[model samples]
Target chain A: MEATKKNSWLTENRRSAIAAYLFISPFFILFAIFGLFPMLFSFYLSFFRWDGLDPMTFNGLDNFRFIFSDPIFYSSIQNTFIIGLLGTLPQIVVSLLIAFALNSSLIRFRNTFRTLIFLPYITSIVAVAIIFGLVFNNQPFGFANYILSLFDGGPIRWAAEYWPVKFAIATMVFWRWVGYNTIIFLAGMQSIPRELYEAAKIDGASIGQQLRLITLPMLKRIVMFVVFTATIGSLQLFTEPLIFLGRGLREEGITVVAYLWRDAFVYNTFGTASAAAIVLFVIIITLTAINLALSNLIGRSKRRVS
Target chain B: MSTKEVGEGKFSIKKFFVYLVLVGAGLISLFPFYYMFVMSTRLNREINSVPPPFTPGNNLVENFQKVTDSIDFFGSMWNSVIVSSTITFGTLFLCSLAGYAFAKLPFKGKKVLFALILVTMMVPPQLGLIPQYYIITTLGWLNDFRAIIVPGLINAFGIFWMRQYIEDGVPYEIVEAAKMDGCSNFRVYWNVVVPMILPAFATLGIIVFMHVWNDFLWPLVVLRDPSVHTLQVALRALNDAREMDYGMIMSGTFWATVPLIFVFLLFNRLFIQSLSEGAVK
Candidate 1:
């Protein structure tokens, strides 16, 4: 009887395993075809010179060497970092403040504010870029310049000028993303226990003191999450700048990803584009690792203190 | 008594400052959409006039006509609908199936396979664009909708999200009970597990739809024929044609953004609630 029951159980388990594999087979098949094979093939192509038509010639490390010496490659990198910093720093500080304000008891219609702000995030980036392009148009009647005039200033060439192009792109990035980070930060803020605030208040902590002592310290993990995502996202910044600067600005604000797209698709420099992409991937990974280590250290120290 | 009064006065002043900052920030956050809507109604000359019109104009119908002529607005809209809907349904079904397997079924090498899926998330999509383009071109699938819809059907993030939802939301006892009733493994998942994770399905559905609808780069690369172009790519063609016509471009943009705005307004609260809850995990 025991042997019969054991055999039945084994048979049942085998049947379930078969079903499970059948269910998961689609993902495995698709990933193998589209995801894995393409990745490996790209790595292979990185070592060869191919222009999408002719037979690929093995070039070894020539592509990498050429990329290193290329002036346009360096400029693309500089533009990406400058735009990333300009966009990311203000976004972080403003999002934290917005999240803090929403978390406070003094705010009215809190949910309304949160949802309204988050609307920008859900709007299509292409649409956002198009709208901002018109607003930043260097014409005499441009909305931004018109506003500047109200402040006793002349119309600024918002898109044509280099610095203004960076500012315009950064502004769009900030507008679209601030609400996303705010929502994330609000989640982090809500997770903090109410008793922490009460305890701080009893100790005669002022509002700013409580924010510094109780809020920021508790928000370390959330901050890390935001920073890491924002950093990775900044590295891959393409669409907004591509639309805004590529069309409105003098093509001088091309991001690294945009540059990659132009080279691989437009210019057909496949090998060099692949090399640039690989370099970007390495930079992103290194930055993410540093962020993770720093966050982990901070988390450990906070745990010890508590 | 004087010190206490002083403290109260300072607190009120700070509170006023906080409200002021919040209001200012909110306006800045919302100003672009406001501007887009305002610009869509004005004519080209009006848009380029000094001290541009701050309010809505009466030229909306004319601008709409130009927008339609510049791009096949309805056809591209249909294309977007078809593509986004197909991908969303495919992702929901396939991802849920895989997620169920990872969460409930005890299979050999499951841990390793799950880890592999996780690692794929870190590999940026741009890295594979060249090879992917070649593959599609070689297979003669360049202009086919399947090129966009199929490859992205079962994404890593979707699988991971569904697994997370299943692990937390569904009970193993239900599966065991279904088995005792002589139900097949597929029957258990189809009848029991899927209903339990409907909230997750909705959240994932919205995100996937939005992404596929707004996607520009891949469609631009793969689909060259105007008939095969999605809405964003079609709109880009319009922008290129009348590069200097701010009114027509703004009108096209305004139309492009309307559907999403409508969807968001209808479900914005649900989205926010789900997002907040999802973040807790």
Candidate 2:
């Protein structure tokens, strides 16, 4: 009887283990085929020279070397950083402030405000580009220009020139993503214990004082996370510029991903596109490492100060 | 209420300024959308008028007809709906199952597998565009909705999220008791585990729904044919291929945005709470 009971227990354990494996198999199977394989294959293709249709030749370091000399690739990187910074820094600061306000008691219809603000981010980017195109139409009576005219600034040619194109893209990026980060920051703010704020209040800590002394310090990790995500996202920036330029025009607001798409699809240079993607991958990793180190330093310094 | 006096001396000009800024920012957030609605109603000729009709115009019906006729707008909408819902439901099922296993089940290599999933999230998928495209092409999934939907159905983030829910929301004692009663693992998950984590299911559902709807780059790559084009892809095609009127394009924009706005409004607090709660602890 004792041996039979032990045998039944062993069978149960084995059966359940099988069930657990079965449950998780789909994700692994899908990831293997779609995610991992493609990623590894792209790395291999970066070292080869081939258009989409042609026979590939194993060209060692040629694709990377070609990109180094490519002026458009360099310009695309410049545009990416320019647009990323223009959008990200303001977004971080503004989002923090907005989150602070929403968390404050003075604001009424708080949920309504958040919903309205976040609405822009959820709307299709294609729609955003198209709508902004009309507003920034550069004509004398264009919506943005007409608003500018109030300050005696004539039609600013919002999308016609280099800087303006970056500004336009930046503004679109800002409008779309600011609310998202605000919601994130606000969430972080709400999680801070109320007793601490009450204690600070008893000690006559002002709002600004509390914000600087308590809030920002506490939010350092979340802020870093937001910064990291914003960095990664901006690095892969593509669609807004692609459609905003009306498809054929790759001159203004072209991002790295946009440049990649154009190269792969327009120029049919698969090897070149793969190499650029690898370069982008390296840039993302290095920036992430830098950000991680900086955040760590800040975290340690704050701990020491306390 | 007591917060109003945190730093300020009394109810003064500063309070007024704070409200002003708040209201002003809200209006700025909404102004583009208002402009979009206004342009959607008006013809390009009227849209270009010196004071560019700040108010809604009467050309909505005409523009709607023009855009729909230029491209298969409704067809694309149907395609988007199918793609988004399929992926959302599929994700909810698959992610929740895997999450339960990783969170509750004692299996060999569980820790290593979870670690691998975490690692995958760091590798940005867009960087592998060429080879991913080749994978789709190899499988003959080009111009197929599955090319977009299938790859997206099993995101690492969703699995991580669901695992957190299962670990926190469901008690281990309950699973043990169910098993002692001779209940199968899947049955325990379906009856007890699922009902307990409905909130998680809803949050993940809405997040996936919104993402799949707005997804562009992948769909643009996969759907080569017009008939199978997702809404965003089809909209781009319409804009580039036709000499579209500004009103018509705005009309398409309005059409794409309205459904999401409605969904968002209904689930605003649910989404906000989940994201906040999920992000915080």
Candidate 3:
């Protein structure tokens, strides 16, 4: 019986299936322990209140209740959107322009230019935040201040107040990511048919007109992708604010993720942190779904127009 | 003839403005980096001075001493290397194995499993922040390097990238020929599929390595120890200790950023290709 079973298992389909199982086991195993378990535990923890050390006491809707009344949480959501718009809007436009320029025939040394522009993305964000902190140091001799002095403007508190803190973080976000989006746009542009551009040129369309009529419409899907992804990323903005502020859980520059970090680790309010994480996660999913729906509508409308 | 000449002049002027814009954008991207390098060399006083020295300062040795004196800089970097390199190689192995199976092997549930993997790739992994900490501490993995490394080894994106690459690049005829010669599935993958996908390996290696190297959020959570801290984590500690000491923080940042920048400069062609190819858009 054993011999027959072994022989049966040696069939090609069974053998390949076994091999495939072995090959794919690592990801499943790791994912179970790391990704799926953590996500489930996070959701589960939202219902019960537990510090890192003590046993969990079951609390019904307390975490959610607390979040609703927390003024800081509301402001963090507001600050997050403000920073998101400030960072993402310009990044999209600027990177789009750069990608267009890089694609045009007038540019030389394209590879060199591309490498230099992408340099910021590769550096550590901790480093970027620290560097920007000093550059925008609200002192007489600071680089930003010196530039301001040239225009008779006094030193601006780039990190002290609410708006400047958001501005500083937004600038950091824009700096690190603009090149990445530019490259994406460049790839999207490259994927378009050259014949379209040739046709536009033959039709006496100038560069700006060609860009408006052909390129932007063609890039709708990619633009939606950028918007949704940037929304998700901006919602989770943590490191820059954390480093820039140099204080634990300061009110001025706290993002939702930063707030989550403080509640769990600083205040040992793990349940509140878990609730906030879930809230942020829900927002991200909703935004991405909306973006997808809008993009689909535009896609269909364009198809109808054609 | 005169009208055409005027139009040509106008076009040249527009081209000049485009170049100006492109060059300005490039400078803005790089100016912070230049500032980082310059500030790293200056003392606190020099950085705080009225003229704000643009040139390099002679405080290099002092700041280097101050940084190492405060933090376990080398140990932290070694931990970062171990984490990133381990994840890099692990992703290459596991991702390729699964990718090859998905693309080449006639396996049961291939479509279902591959679809699940692709689905996971669509969503961002930012949901379980505090809960992740709970699980990590429960597993008694706090302050452990494995906490950072093990959880990070498997990524759906890496698997997707490998599958797409293998399917597009690797021909089926050779895989069939190897199978006909009585090679087992694993051997066929090990001997034939991997060699054919070297360029894919390089691109994936760089990407996986870059992600692991630059990963801050997760590592910041688990790596509470100074010894096991990655570069970014360590730099955070260093900056906090020498708070407002621009020289020390900048020097640390400069050194921490140098290795990846070095590698990037060397393999820019491969590096940029990976970025563009791996772009979600």
Q: Which candidate has the highest TM-score of all?
A: 2
Off by over 4 Å in 3: A1-10, B1-10
| The 10-residue segment with the lowest total lDDT in model 2 chain A | A244-253
Q: DockQ for model 1? A: 0.56
**Per-prediction DockQ scores?**
0.56, 0.66, 0.62
Q: What is the DockQ of candidate 3?
A: 0.62
DockQ value of candidate 2 = 0.66
True lDDT of residue A125, candidate 2: 83
Reference-based lDDT, residue B161, model 2: 95
**Against the hidden true structure, what lDDT does model 2 obtain?**
0.85
DockQ class, candidate 2: medium
Candidate 3, residue A103: Cα displacement in angstroms equals: 1.1
Compute fnat per model: 0.59, 0.65, 0.72
- Where is model 1 more than 4 Å wrong at Cα? A1-6, A152-154, A247-251, B1-11, B276-281
Considering only N, C-alpha and C atoms within 3 Å, which residue pairs clash in candidate 1? Answer: none
Q: Write the per-residue lDDT of candidate 2 for residues B177-263, one digit (tens) a residue.
A: 998777899999999899999989988888888789988899998899999999999888866755647888888888878888887
TM-score of each: 0.94, 0.95, 0.95
TM-scores of chain A across candidates: 0.92, 0.92, 0.93
Tens digits of per-residue lDDT for model 1, A110-188: 8778888788888777777778877787766887888888897887787767788788888888888998888889889
Q: Candidate 2, clashing residue pairs?
A: none
Scanning candidate 3 chain A in windows of ten residues, the lowest lDDT window is A1-10
For model 3 the local lDDT of residue B134 reads 72
Chain A TM-score for model 1, please?
0.92
